[model samples]
Target: MHSTNAPASRILVTGVGANPGFGLTRSLTRLGHTVIAADARPHAPGFLLPTVIPQVIPLAADPQYSDVLEKVCRDLAVDAVVAGIEHDLVPLVDMRPRLKATGVRVWLPDAESVHACIDKAAFHAVLTANGIPCPRTWLPEQIDEIPDGVELVVKPARGHGAQGVHFVNRREHARVLCELVPAALVQERLYGHEFTADCLVDRDGVASVILRRRDLVKAGLAAVSTTFDDPVVRDLVVRTLNAVRARGVCCVQGFVSDDGAVAITELNMRIAGGFPLTEAAGADLVGQMVNGLFGLPVDHGRLTYETGKVLTNYVETLAVGDAEAPQRNGHSRPVASPAVQVRPDARRNASPFLYGAETAAVGRVLRSGQYGHTDVTEEFEQRVARFLGVPDAVAVASGTAALHTALLAAGIGPGDEVIVPSLTFCATIQAILATGATPRFVDIDPATLCVTDTLIMDAVTDSTAAVVPVLFGGRAVDLSAVRDELQERGIAVVEDAAHAFGSRTPDGRRVGATGALTCFSFGPIKNLTCGQGGMVIPRSPQEADRVRRMRLLGVVQSQDERANTTTYRVDGFGLRYQLSGINAAIGLAQLDHFATTANERRRLWRAYRDALTGLDGITLVDVGEDATPHLCQVLVPDRDKVFAALRGQGIGVGVHYPPNHLQPAFATWHRGTLPATEQVGEQILSLPFHQHLTDNDIEHVVSVLAAALDASGGTS
Candidate 1:
């Protein structure tokens, strides 16, 4: 039932499949005022929202979702339409006047600013008009007029990210260039230092800024960034923002030549991708932007940040899988380890992960120096790479470090902003912050837990950098569509596939194989246990090479005998976060156990469903086609009581998470509500069913759950 009393203070956020955008959408809708989510994909994460809230309009409306988006504003009498995806932004802006005519509002950069923000050539020209120097460029339409002495760089005028930028050494590729560019540009790539700036210009035209220097870690998003107050670049940013006439959370990017001239590269007319870092650095950007856009007064000059501080992605390490247990190396009925490292019994029940292997493994590694090159480590990384069908893999210290390393290789840094989901783990947000880039926490789809396109568009600004999609145990986010959108935009995407090691999409491809940089975890709790290790799988060999060197400092690691050694030419101060040899060995052993492990999990999941399906109010996860059961999840009305009752019965149950936005450190950006996340979060619970459990164990778990539900009055 739609609320007739919905307030105008409510904002509707769309883009349900994309992570951050969905986060924003969920947060707003939870406030119980008004929010309409729309997505092109039917099963996008946002659509999975509980039926209690009005359903998200399929981006493909009844007439096709875009049309529905228009009607939603009129029907709901919504106050503002939050544009979430970049592709959706322009059209939403085009619909603005008609929406307003019906008394609804849509937040977007004006059409002119949209073109300037999205098109490389148009953006460069605008920058030049504002006296902000850009890379020397000649559009293909003006190709014959190219002057004789411009040492050549080339790019497609309409391109986004680094898609069309190329260094042309030969004239032969010129014809190849035309296919990409309606007109390509032959420019002089300058000798300049790259940096990004997160600045906000209020409706009154004031610029508040922070400049960060890109550092030594991952390339696409910064492994780390240091802030510097550069008056020159900051002023240039102001000039560029003024030229674009953008009024939201805009981030501008440019380069400083050796001669110290500042040139504008582009503008993010919406919320830039890297805004999360700003929030983590103690800046409440979402609240500020929402406040600023709605005719609220913003104090732009009141912000300040510490210089040279660093943040890193939070990490969950991997453990190598052991080969099938029965026939593996003849270590049949195992003897006890020399010293059993059990936790003091009481704390053991409170832990989520299994530390049985780790306790034994860590003690051994400290004694044996063979950590990196252990047969166990190599075997596990190789198998995981093969399982994901990726070309190569490098085991790192943890999943967070894997993301940080992938960003370092991609070259994301200071002044850059990476798009992330506020509904996801704090680790992703912190990873971008570590690189001195801003993290734009986009909204999320409540059902799929994936991000939607609408949120991505609303948050994009001139300094927008990259996009990251997290597949949380692979329920419903489709990376193929997300990849398509990002590719066309010229931005890079990195997959944070920590919880999705063995999952697949509706298409048969593995979750980590979607032509993007994917990072996986083998933490103690993952489907495949690595006491502590991670792997980065890139889409291309060049990208693979880039991440390879960046993973272990800047020095390259060739595929040679010496490549496995620790002693080498370290290029920079890299983190000592490589996976240990001991952890690797355990992972390899688990690899032998893979088929059975996965099979057991699926069978257990089905059993849980069949047994619990007859009950009322407890909703078992719907895996649709194309998903490997990772955790057995259920939604119940009285979660605390159910959880407590099960615990009392000695049947351990778990929770997937608490939304990152509500964490105390992030509370300032909470924006008042996150109904779907908070409500669903409470009802969600994971049942125990590792390979060690038997069929009888499954029955016992179901019985306990049933009794708990009945005791809690859910059956009534």
Candidate 2:
């Protein structure tokens, strides 16, 4: 009678493919509420649930994810949203304000509390600082401090579903695994009977806890559980929840050792996968949760549960092979055909692929009616800025636009000169020409294929305005050393990082994070593509603003005006180089999977390196450990003949560049003699490298190249 009674409400639940979301959706339907189950995958099993609406949403890491969720909530008139997976928790919490504007209720802990539970290391620190009983945990850097012969658990600090969790008994093994696991945390292994507390904390901070013993576990899911009653355990669960500042519905897990002491393991800010047992044991958990969700007072009498009731889970086949059938009422249905699968060998050119996220993003822009530079473009810039650890980023039409904008913002013009590597694409020279500045071509280091400090210093003059160091094939130039030698002289270092989107430095810092100015390309062949786009990361706020203006024809405040639906005046000189909203949408989608794509590229390059080792008449480019290779380039004798031979065998290959100094347009401005660059230009050949290439494809390429070498009678 707390005025919380309302008609059945519509709710959206994320990660419905997982056990918690799936189960939660089923329970909500039983309670007479409409459920919208969402998942990143199109064919998630949760979509098959009766009386539930299924939605395909982009992954949380996607740049446009929050926007899409907001649109969905508004379109469907959803009344509430609940996260069923840890991955979606952070995004939903961050979108609280937007959801509130739409009057969609969400029950979740604060951002800090949610993060503390999701990050295991933070959870351990919180409990330990609060004088709670928890296992000893150490970060990867502290692995050496662990004693020998002690059982340990090495796992990713932010992992869920027990993935990447490894058990070890030696410090050495832990140390070795620390190198493999991302953001690893090592903890002392605990042995005892494990229990889960299904908890609900009302808005007033009062708690209701249901204890369940996990009698059997499989793949991190509780397969069998029994209801239990223990005051000592319930009190400890409440205390631990207080320590972490947890509210709303959550689950706490721990162990009861032989010494009769409880040590906390981890806390999840979501319902337990085995939560059905609490209801089966006679507790009205879900009903009270819905009441609390609508700001109603909980009924404590209904929260009581009987002890010794058991629930066992088993796998069942809910679906089988695809089939088509006509309705009994004589209605016909259309059945779509399956997609055709293509083999890697069938393609004779470099692979340029697209993911579903890209198509969805582009479609979103097309429907929004604002196709010019808009909010989506700004969001894409912000995402790239965060990824590069830079203060600001500007998106433009192409790699040339990025460099042109950065150079103009840096105050370079007619009388100034920009130093560039001779062994680079023609775009570098074109950008310098666009700035009305002279291009000073310099020789590159034979091994790195990048301009060195010695070459840069030797090329410097009183008229030198900047140094443009090209990150050729994703190999990072020694920017730190280059800065030390050039910054004191007041010359800017503008990095041409077109081929190095996800490359990192030796110290683990991302490439664009530092340097005076950096530019990235998203052309068809780059690591992360937006179909066609570019980005500029500036060191200072003033430069960022200037670059922003320059990209839109010098129209002052055009970007702001577009977002606010206002008009702005034209200012100083600029160009129509701003990236379109549709392209930015694609770029945003690509950024979501940038890390995975980069790692896969690196893996493919390594496989090629290992397979071709000691091959006669072929020398691989020595890409440094810190680099993420964009293309696998090698120096070969009779390069043109080898290139033709590979193409004939359906193994695509090409030359990266013919030295810029030798190009007709750049020949007039060439100043220095680039012996190393000229020599490399004649011998370098780029191999087909992309994430879609399999090991078998690589082996075939190697075999074709070896045979071509033998036929040419070159250094057998």
Candidate 3:
């Protein structure tokens, strides 16, 4: 019988198909413990392990991942959970509380430590902050600072397994690779002997490190390695582990440079793939790890190993021929199933209409290290200008920023009055107020649900500095009439084209193409979104330049400083309202697929229009030929009852506005009774809309809405 104080327990090991997880599972079982192996891939080879119970789980990014993992642990009665992969670390760290409540132990570092190890940029910062020697690193935005012909390695800042890593000698190549690599980080390529340290940290923060020289590395895995005793390397590795506050079984990798200096590369929060070499060299690594995992003392004496113990790894097929498709468990259900699962109060208010390209663009910006305003933001601005056929465009942080900057640029300030639609978003009034100008609320035309030229002309006075005609529901207003009347009276027209990005006039001119100052919103529910961003299409380059300066705290040439590290002069008033490079990247990516997305959106809107043509108690908004609807809204009776019924059936609904003039914050600004605006506010209901909604989803939503209208005693 085996004599050991470490009790045999049921352990759940994730990423079992990977070498470290697979090897760890086998070793634990050999030490007389039950192994429950889990993997996101159904056909993971670890499932073939003898006497192991295997379960398939969702990828770490899945929304249902946490629930599925908890269910697995609860069902299997797992005593401890061990993550075998780096990607699983964040999710597991988030689930630590629930797992502990179920009496399952986990051996991992704190959230900050895990992130530091996983994110290369953060790791570089941590080590550098602690006076540790590490490779010189630069974010993509700082690529221009790299010396010419310097050897560089462009890799994902949050990468694993050497995937998407590129090596080059020119700074330009690094820049090009940044576009391709996800969350790319540029570093000085290290040359010399690479080493891996198999490490174990106890609860008291004491760490044991076993040094090994990597003789040959293939595809990020050590092909040939030998255990060695180097106090210098071991000491440095321990210092790095401490810098990251790492705990339990983890790995530290670095290189002994040609200059005889050790420069740490990265630290892994889990066991090294070649840890078996340590065990072969006489260290009971896994045994001691389990001892520390279950609240027992680690035998440091057992961690000692002899020098020159070699390990050679070679790939061999563990299985041949056709393999059976493994059954997916724990929230991996088929999407094609006819039955729809509805959850109570699960109606999403608004969701970003994302495509896979958004992630790719975000990765490029992250790798470039220019999270602030940079080339990507400029590129997006240029694209928007071209698409709208405008002379220039200025991208800002939000729609309100765009409006505020545009008004300020147009010389609107205190003692000035700006005409706004009362039935529109409160942001319109807020933007005017932000410019220190009074908002003159005017009633909307009942036919268009938009402020007409007559309303603007009536609200005008000697104090009227600008007229902001809001395009409701992606529909264009009487831009020509408003522009002609307002300009003759010396009143500037700043079209609040927040909902009319793609809408055009009857003359075929895009809504933003010909306006003096057109502000477009890219908020979450807007037709096009940059997560949360906005742009201003200026009539002249001078206006664009002024808006740009105003966005960067009114610093003249501030944008130039972002491109090249240099001092800038602040000459006027400005706000820190510049859009970030990452959000701009998302916007550029969204434009790349705008054609498809716009067409799809139009198709869905048309479908809704056709289905509800004669439906009683609800009337669809009359969208013109030049209009591309951002929202499918209806004027309905018993709006609250219909909203509740639709929400109860898992359909999301929204009330566009509550009459900005009547809002508590704007109640003081309330002037005359705008009967049209008040009546429309009570009747308008915005239906769920986005690029991702399928034809089936639209049909289902319409069906629920029709039933809701009938339940409220509406004529059908």
TM-scores of the models, in the order given: 0.47, 0.55, 0.54
Q: How far is candidate 3 from the true structure (C-alpha RMSD, Å)?
A: 22.7
> Model 3 over residues 1-716: C-alpha lDDT tens digits?
11235665778898887888888877776665667778887656665555456668888888888898888787655789999889899999999999999999998889999999999999999999998999999999999999886899999999887788889999988999999998899999999999999999999999889998999999989999999987888889989988998889999999997777999998999888899899999888898999988989988888889889999998755445543332334443221112221111115545555544576689989998879889899899989989888777899999989999999988899989888889888888989998899988899876678887777788888989998988888888875766776778778889888888788888889888876688999987677889899998887878888998899998887556545865667889999999999999988877865665566567768877876877778888866767777877888888888888888887888988889999899887789899998888888888887644544456677788889988898755
RMSD of each: 26.5, 21.2, 22.7
**Cα deviation of 40, candidate 2, in Å:** 27
TM-score of 3: 0.54
lDDT tens digits by residue: candidate 1, 125-229 = 887787776776666656566655555666666544455567665444544675665557666656566676777677677767767655533423445666666
With a 3 Å backbone cut-off (N, CA, C), the pairs that clash in candidate 3 are: 139-368, 140-368, 140-369, 141-368, 184-367, 554-574
Q: Weakest 10 consecutive residues, lDDT, candidate 1?
A: 341-350
Mind giving the per-residue lDDT tens digits that candidate 2 earns over 1-716? Answer: 11124345678888888898888887776555667678876556676665455667888889878987887777555789988899899999999999999999888889999999999999999999988888899998888888777899999999986799999999889989999999899999998888999998888778899999988989888889999988989998999889877878889999888788998888999888899999898778777888877777777677789999999997755456545332222101112113212222313335554433576689999999988898899999999998888778989999989999999888888989999998888999899998999999999887778888888998899999999999998988875766876878878888899999899888888989865599999888688888888999988989998998888888877655556965677778999998999999988877765655676677778888987987899889877777878878888888888888888887888788899998888888877578999899988988888755655567778888899888877657
Model 3: residues >4 Å from true position, as ranges? 1-346, 561-567
Candidate 2 — number of clashing residue pairs?
0
Model 2: how far is 53 from its true place, Å?
A: 31
Q: Which residues of candidate 1, in runs, are more than 4 Å off? A: 1-369, 373-376, 452-461, 557-568, 668-672
